[model samples]
Target: MYHVVVALDEDADRARRQSRAVADLPQAAREVRATLLHVFTDGEGASATEVGAVRRASDVLNNAGVDVEVIERSGEPAATVLDVADRVDADCICVGGRRRSPAGKAIFGSVSQSVILQADRPVLVTGGFEE
Candidate 1:
């Protein structure tokens, strides 16, 4: 199976885009296993499956016949995502990219950028839907 760690955030659009990218993979139903990961920065005890963005992404992947699992964690987003991806031995890490200025990224730090740069495996970055 081609295992993937899909890092999701509160942005429903970004989640949808990330899910589509995975679902569109070759033989997704037969070969892809997606782990939907959500990191809670705030100390909320909410389940990952309960998050709106995660639910929407799960629906999309389910409709496309991809095997899915949901995991929730509390920590720094990028670091948590990387640690989970490593633990899962993911073949790829999927993340949604937000448009940010270089300076903005420099100051705020980009999760997608961090994952891309740090992951030992391939990273797939899906852009937010253009309106």
Candidate 2:
């Protein structure tokens, strides 16, 4: 089975886009498995599976007939995502990216950018809808 790690954040739209990207994969139901990961920063103690964004993504994947798992971690978002992906031996890492100027990205330190640059395996970045 092809495995994908989908890194999700608080944005519902971003989660939808990321989940849809995975659900749209070829023969997704028969061949793909998706792990939904959410990293809680600043020592926030919350259930990842209960998070709205995660739930929405899960619903989408479930509707598409893809096998799904939810994982929660606490730490820097990018680092945590990479660590979990490695632990799970994911075939691909998926993340949602918002449109940002070079200066904006440089100043804001985008998690998606960091994941893309640091990941050893394939990374699928889904762009958010035009704002």
Candidate 3:
């Protein structure tokens, strides 16, 4: 049974792509457990809006026939994700990295890199609404 954690960024494209990946992940997966994680970026990253999104995602997943969980927390995005990974002992963390220029990445660093480096498990990263 693998535990998959997806970081739900507010971008519609990212969310769509993330949804595709999760929905299409091999149905053969034994004991598949999926979780939608959102961080509210106000120093703690826990916002009512984010929490609602996660809850909505969870409902969608449930309707799709997959057991799902929604988790919302307050903290740095990367830090919050890593912390959740620990609590859930996740097998993989999925996130989307906006395609940005070198300058942008330099200024913002990489969310994917942060999760990969900070997490104890593997990280799956993709651009928003990959088509």
If scored against the real structure, what TM-score would every candidate get?
A: 0.95, 0.96, 0.80
lDDT per residue (tens digit) for residues 1-131 in model 2: 99999999989889999999999999999999999999999988889987999999999999999999999999999999999999999999999989877787778888988999999999999987533
Q: In candidate 1, what are the lDDT values of residues 1-131, reduced to their tens digit?
A: 99999999988889999999999999999999999999998798889888999999999999999999999999999999999999999999999988877788789888888889988999999875432
How would you encode candidate 3's per-residue C-alpha lDDT over 35-89 as one tens digit per residue?
7888777665355345544555555556566667776776688988888888888
Per-residue error at 103 for model 3, in Å? 0.3
**For model 1, what is the alpha-carbon lDDT of residue 106?**
82
Residue 53 local lDDT, model 2: 97
RMSD of each: 1.6, 1.1, 3.2
How does residue 72 of candidate 3 score in lDDT?
A: 74
Looking at model 1, which ten-residue stretch has the lowest summed lDDT?
122-131
Task: Write out the backbone clash pairs for model 2.
Answer: none
Better of 1 and 2 by TM-score: 2
| TM-score head-to-head 1 vs 3, winner | 1
* Model 3's TM-score against the true structure: 0.80
